[model samples]
Target: MIGQISEASPEAPYLAANLYLDPAVISALLIEMSDMREPPLDTGFRISKADPELLDVWRRLIGLLDRPDEVPVMAHHFEHELMFRLLQGPQGALLRQIAGTDSRLSNVRRAMRWIREHFAEHLSIEVMATIAGMSVSVFHRHFKAVTSLAPLQYQKHVRLTEARRRLVSEHDAAATVGFSVGYESASQFSREYKRLFGASPRRDADMVQTIVDPGP
Candidate 1:
């Protein structure tokens, strides 16, 4: 099962919901979906105008959340249908372009992947450009186009997300986690972390833990 709910407008507090269901199980459906061939173009999935039918389906799906255990199942179905519709829609051109070519967008994606996988180490635009098979200037242009963030900014986001995750699971100090994520200066790490998350590491960690394991 899958669904979506939309507020009346950007500022509305209440939402109208819709739901959808398919006979196939989510995992099996995903496998079959992965096997389907795609067109060779740069169309990304986008919904230009809202569809009432789709909105109705999404509302019904939201009704199923009364059972928490079924949330994952419903979410999978919702994503599958949403993606399918988007791919079949007009904006799918951007998606197709990225999918079909060894274009700059592809290079940006490659660089992003490498940065995510190796964020614990020092990152240089030169090294990233080499991985993307482009000159530094070209790489920067493409990277900015695809992500709207510079390489270093993207790296900081990755590092911060990872550091926050680690802070929740590991018993290490904030400085230790900062250094492990490639920051040599603890104070710099603290400052950046606060800037991004709007709170210091220790405070952020406490909030995350409270959310993860709440008390009565």
Candidate 2:
């Protein structure tokens, strides 16, 4: 779900710690905890400032890295505590939906996976609706509500995102990359690419390349 992640600073280098939550682990904990479920959230993602208890759990979890031998035994426990603390936070509702198999957020995520996989193909709203197991109108409404983008609009975002990656990493021609991403007209691709990225494809790639490999 994370397309890109980075940290930048003018003085000291940026430093942070992160964790990956296992849905199985979360679901197991949910079984023991009663009345933890909440109404479905329009969006699955949530952000909250970590409180002291959550920070303490994070610290203990990070400490495991230093004691590699203990990690095999204790890491899972710490991860569970971490998720438990999170489930008690403001983000709890969103996390609960993530663990629900039939939640609307899950259905939307299913469709999102499909879009990411078939982004270069012609987008079919009907197919996306079916994938989400909703009628066309219902799917469109829910998709937009959850993701803030219509189906075709989401496809455009996926296409442009991928085009950026291919341009930067593969150094392919803009037109070729555009065609490969289902854009029929090179000019249309360039125009939209600029609209989204604030620069033409080649220019943005060059800019990124400059940042990546600055010469002496």
TM-score of each: 0.64, 0.89
lDDT tens readout by residue for model 1, 49-162? 757755555665676677778877777766566545544556444544454447556667778889999998888999999999999998887677666678889899899988
How far does residue 9 in candidate 2 sit from its true spot (Å)? 8.7
Per-residue lDDT, model 2, residue 41, is 67
- The 0-to-1 C-alpha lDDT of every candidate, in the order given, reads 0.70, 0.86
TM-score of 2: 0.89
RMSD of each: 8.3, 2.4
lDDT of each residue in 42-61, candidate 2, tens digit only: 76555679999999998888
Candidate 2: residue 146 lDDT (0-100): 81
Candidate 2: residue pairs that collide:
none
Q: Tell me the spans in candidate 1 whose CA falls farther than 4 Å from its real position.
A: 1-84
Off by over 4 Å in 2: 1-13, 16-18
